[model samples]
Target: MSFRLTTRGLTIAAIFLTVVVVGIGVALAATSTPQFCGTCKSHVPYIDEYKKSAHRDVNCEQCHSKPGPFFFLTAKLEALQQPIAQITGDYEKPILGYVLNQSCRRCHNNDLLFHPVSKNGIRVQHRHLIEAGFLCMRCHSTQAHGDAVPPGSRTYPSMDQCLICHNNQFKDPQGQVATSRCDLCHTKPNYGAVPLTHKQNDWATRHGAVGILSTCSACHVKKGACSDCHKGILMPHPAAWISEHGVIVGKRGGNKACDQCHDTKEYCKTCHQVKMPHPAGFVDSHPAVTAQKGSDTCFNCHVVANCQACHDLHAAGDPRAHKLLGGANSSLQSTPTPISSPIAGGG
Candidate 1:
């Protein structure tokens, strides 16, 4: 038979239960601290950066854990693997973590959303973003960690991030469009502030080489902003532009305009397969040159009328034209191989 519980036994049991509860509470509190997180060598760099960040005064859990007891407990339970992973050296490189919008709103508050907040000349309308269901971490991901991680891992907001939603095409629930006007977001934006890349002497000529046209498009939002300076030539020209550029060049009255972006002297000669402008006395030597290159190459710059102008004289039985026609025919007969059209080949 089971023995009856005595007063002494009951008192001792109650004290033991209380002690266990208090011990668990203490352990949970201790582990939630940034100090406890920093104990893992992998977290030391993040902790160091967090200490220097604007949110240094805020506890790690205040942002990392969502508000309410259930989420707090859940975050704590999820954190249990950190120590195990650290011991086994099995943690992921560039450790990833997500901060909930609820966690941010706990301190930031809904009041901040009603009005735009200015930071570093940027006017951010939180209400529009929050209503649109954007996460606080979408822009402020690096606020606590700073640049502790690699560039790809750092989620600090940039013009590109803003352009994702502020591209004028994106509309709110109320049908109000998100315009990409710099004035809407930038308070007294120094539009004249030349980028560091633009400050270089050769930037005017070499800007296309950087391959960051999206960065350029962020500010140059006009429809033909690039084409304006490019003289209607599409910036970062299309694949077909290589084959079709000859037609464009011909319409523009020679490759003189191409000198704006290209070193036409060398660049043109590479594809032209001959002197681009045709050196002095080219008219005299053109018969041999045309026969060697082909009539198609001539069509790149000259129409059939150009050849007809000289050939018509031969029809009239001019002595000089007869001599020139004989030379042209002889050269044409000698070159049996046919050359393809430079216009078609984009030569």
Candidate 2:
């Protein structure tokens, strides 16, 4: 018995849809909460410190009084305030030395923090943060207190903090304060900012030289003035380095800039002394002669020293008389081994 009634079908569908909508609404209501206080995101310091704050009288509504919630709401209010300010020209200028006075006045303002010394008043007049119109939150508080952080609520400069702003470099060995964050000068302090000059020096063609761009900058005291910044051995070409390199018994550079990174003799000997490419039988036949090949690391299998032997550290270009791994003492030469097949074992 099929009775086709169009109005009844439409009514039934609407009722089912209404039930589904109400069910979804109830589920959403159960899970959500109303943000009445707006304190969920940034409330800090256990509510007690805030109550003790000098601005404790200032309501959350006066500053945070705008409609809606969160940063987006604040931003919209700020945009609207800007236009109103333009029309009215009313900028909310903070009080001068405001934060210090407010925080100090919270407990001791007139005579209590200091002995009310008139001479101290002369010294206190030099307060830069006060002149900067910074609020207490700007340089000192839980949210804003790294040494590098700009002045805020969580920040309180120590005694060394004064010297950090001074022209002279202050070192507090006690580790109480690290004033490295303060700019010595406007010049950038990062090591990576310096350019690498050594790469241009012909070594790039041979062994594929590479170095960190900032390594040189770390030693540089000031930007661009290499001589003024680094003195003595720190200089690119120290007189001491030349004196040491010239007299050393072993061949240097061989067009290899080993000295750039390595500061000592042991670095070269460790590898070269072990696996020098001399004839395989030479090690067993003449251990003393093969082992005694100083800086044998450069000597390749040809029985003669390679370019590393005679290679000039000063000027890397080829000269007519230049030979690889300069002439070794053949005066104590080893006898050559007879050619033997791999199948014919040597005793």
Candidate 3:
């Protein structure tokens, strides 16, 4: 059936279409509210946190959605799954969400970029940070959500987070290094105030285990601060230090420095098997000492060639030397006796 459109029929159809479009727009605006977002069980705690945040006056869609209209419409369409997931009880446990940098810049604008702001006790210059490609959410993730999330997932800015980039190694495109100095970021930093971690009884020895070593470097800026306590050794010993440490101690003349951190009397003696560097008269007394403890103890520091080199000086006429050396030529013999056996004053 072919029907021609009359003026009355066309006018009615246009009004009906306009009303439907306006109604859809009204529904979209209504559902974008925090109150509507809170209707979902997963978003209740987050909405409560948002209401108490500094951004309490800001709408949910302002930070949660991107800046432009196209992104805002896409975000709304993506949120269609929230009702379905809520009903089915299959949503993610912590319901992760992200705010784009563009959304943050929309409200913060270029004014924040060039100006330095004093917040709490921090002096923040957003110009360098934003230009360096850091996302606003990197340090301010909890600006809206607060601590509504779980422990490990909490995104509040911390000294640890600041140290990640503010460490002296990170450089800008212009080759200026990021300053790790506390005064650079902290407005009124009390350098004399000891951190609570330093108050622990065992902190002197155990602080290295608590956090990254670079975090300590942030405040203890002096080059000698670590070496002074570490006695010139690396704060955490290098991987091959065990095998090469004796040479290092030899060059330093003694283990007097090692005694600062280690209980060398008990600890070093366990490995050395004798008083290290020997007692004052060890050269003359070692024969008797070796008789008691065995030559295996001497081998910890000395080899068989060392004994041969010294014993060869004994004279054939000296009976005491002859008895100790088992004859002057005995030291020259190619087949050497075990230093532990009775052949060389051991017994």
Candidate 4:
């Protein structure tokens, strides 16, 4: 009535069990490799780029797989759908996947997160962000992988993302407000380590006008930064620039660039009084010139009110003073004198 197994039967069962175990072990090992993942054409470029990454030595599954043995197996099973979706053309282009924070914390361990390193009224600290439960991947999109991203896609974290939390509004757990200040998260920009924007053509001249000096000061200790090279003057102008700037402005036809640093009208009034860039002898010569050349030359620097008020011709109804120097149209007829020396030598 009892069941019995012969020697041949036991041997066959043992051989079959060994083969199944070996097959499963080989399959698991193969699937864990970056090579097997790259078999999907969509992943080929990612794998190639990852080979050059800081994480080149780490297995793909290490950062990709969920923690725990049970979840690890579950992740492997879930991954099978990737190749199937790739074949069926149902996968999203620029293939999207989230890397969990636990996977990152497995290596980054929070001990070194709050190391304070300050430079010029700025400090870098991440303990607050971590305590707030922010994911490391939130700020470091491609920290290890660099640009190992899909074609035409950005793999790095955007400045906009940093600004969202680091802006002037949001307060932290300690009731301290967040800041968009650059030095809070970055060290000083060194000799060759200056940002790419600073290195671009004409950045030195254009940066102030662009109104991003605060952003620059984040990494640059901007106190005396410009004056260091500019010799105490942030703007580029010669010693006699005050006396000569008018001709330079006139030649350019407009004062758009001048507006970057100076309120051109009010600034001119500071030194020129009724007559701007006109020299000491210009007052005497201007009358003769306006008589010969017309008052439009005066209008280049002086407002119509300047002429009317100065000449005691500001009547309520008519600007009769203009008639004495001839009407506005008279300038077209009168020939302009060629001065040997210009005001500022045409900026």
Candidate 5:
């Protein structure tokens, strides 16, 4: 029970233990390099992307690893499992697993964390979002590189970050939205190419249905900006529009607003399948108009069958059928004239 190793034996044991400790230290140091991360085929792309990123000069571990020994070891151990998962085809793509807000705050910590100020008295503060448990990635996903980063391309910011608060659909507790005007954000406006979202093939026709009107108000002040090209159309139509817009459309000779936001053939035909250009009670006035204009006016929209069915005409090639305008009281006809009802197709 009193057995003990000699001093020489103890010294030999100490040297062997020291060699093992040194080997572990060297292994950890070697694997910590960015080059080591580039060794994996899946990680090579991310490493190349990071090399061209804003944080290119910064150490990968600084943002990627936790501070204290326990957490750091946990992170490293988790990282060690990634290669096995990658080989097994179980790894997530785009490399978005890490949440680096704590690492970002380590360097950006200041009074601005609590009280942020904007030059134009606009609310640029983000403390409320932080307090409500939002991560930095929510708004800053592509700060260093775009989500779909191309090789050698400069890091680009997403416009969604600005639109999140500046959009008209978004409002503060006071029910006021930030100004979405172009001059408010840009010194020199680029109005040539519109927003990328607006570049769709059908944008011109479908914008009114899907677009944010406030976004349009950002660049277009809604005065002549709209009517300059639209010429005779009135948009966001005036009050009592249902009762009054017929006159506006008539004065313009056509509905320019309709042509602006719609493909007349597809959109107009779908709704006006039962009717043409005339409104209700038009049947009463069509007699004089058609008589002055001749049968060609009715033939513009109606087929011969429509007139025949209305007039209950037995003869097919009778040009004198034009005399029967506005339902002349002719009981001599076999079938009675059917009344014309307004078409149920107006939106």
Candidate 6:
């Protein structure tokens, strides 16, 4: 009886092994066929094009399969995967800007698509997308939907994105930007937006000759060489002052730069004024503070008042102390014209 049982068991094991081999062969045949109906996309449409892609030879079953018993369960799973197979037909590589299936870097590239770099010759270190837990789908598209879409379908994010972390990048420690004088570096630029901000008819847009934009540091640098224009703190003409200091800030002489050395009435005195004390009346100040330690033009302490100190040009109905600095640049020193510039905050 024992011998008979052993022979019977050996025969059963041989038949089972043969059945397993045949099942494996059948699965391979099914996966290889271009006309298979039941398995993951065996045809691999656009096979020639995929052969040239970076994701060449990545099989469809690898992306849509799970291991299980081969008979009824596998058949049911394949039924669930049919629509997925049909929907992903002839598609290009979907997952862009990330690791390859072999787990290698995809975006470690030599060709720069939009590599961020400093305005100077500095290389901007990019953030690691994988380490940050952001997939390539964060900035790029996939091909699982249909045919591959053009890369340009997405728009570049604006500067507002940088404000997320560098919230205070454009503001001071107090959270307020210093000033935004548009005409500071721009002699005349974009005058369109001014009307939007103010209730005036504005010629505010100073769009330059094609791709020229303004930066924060462009006009705010302390151009302190205005010593020749006046013997004191520099003051610009109110008509030409820019309140926003952006690239659209206009200049006075039809250029995109501020007059670092001159005022509106006179030329850039720093470059044009060869004589000390000026030729005659380039900048006439009042109260004759010339005898004092430091006082030249009306900017002695009157920059806060604009051109109001030198001439009351307007006759408003008030006890206006708005008068010129001196009495025609004659008698260089006397009782001191006793006139002060206008007030700033209701002084």
On TM-score, the leading prediction is 3
Give the per-residue lDDT of model 2 (tens digit) for 1-347.
89687998989989999999998666433322222222322223323444555545543332322333454345344544444554565655321112334533344344543342223112232334344454534334432112222233245433223332332343234433323333332233453432344445664432223433223333334754543332212334444553464333245434133444443354444333444344688535443554354423323223443333533443356453243235643222233122121211111
| Candidate models: Cα lDDT each | 0.73, 0.38, 0.72, 0.62, 0.59, 0.37
What does candidate 2 score on TM? Answer: 0.22
lDDT of 4 by residue, 150-232 (tens): 33444544444455466566777778977766545655554244565667788866676543443444344558776565434
Name the lDDT value of residue 308 in candidate 5: 68
lDDT, candidate 1, 134-173, per-residue tens? 8887878888888886577677555656666776677888
Better of 1 and 6 by TM-score: 1
* TM-scores, one per candidate: 0.57, 0.22, 0.60, 0.46, 0.46, 0.27
Give the Å error, residue 309, model 6.
64
Off by over 4 Å in 5: 1-26, 66-68, 86-96, 110-135, 138-156, 167-177, 188-194, 205-347
lDDT of 1 at 113: 74
- Which model is ahead, 2 or 4, in terms of lDDT? 4
* Runs off by more than 4 Å, candidate 3: 1-9, 165-170, 189-210, 227-347
Superposed model 1: Cα runs more than 4 Å off: 1-10, 191-347
Question: What does candidate 6's lDDT look like per residue over 1-347, in tens digits?
Answer: 34555888999999999999999778655663323532335334334444455545454343333332453346445545655756877434442222232122223442432354442222232342233344333333332222333354432322212222222235534565423443321344454432222243341322211212233122334555332333332333233322333222232233224433224223322111233334566455333333332223334223424545434545365434433334423232323221222322210
Residue 41 miss distance in model 5 (angstroms): 1.1
Q: Report residue 82 deviation for candidate 3 (angstroms).
A: 0.8
Backbone clash numbers for all candidates listed: 0, 18, 0, 4, 0, 33
The global Cα lDDT (0 to 1) of model 4 is: 0.62
> Using lDDT as the measure, what is the rank order of every candidate, best first?
1, 3, 4, 5, 2, 6
120: Cα error in model 2, Å:
13
The local lDDT score (0 to 100) that residue 10 gets in candidate 2 is 89
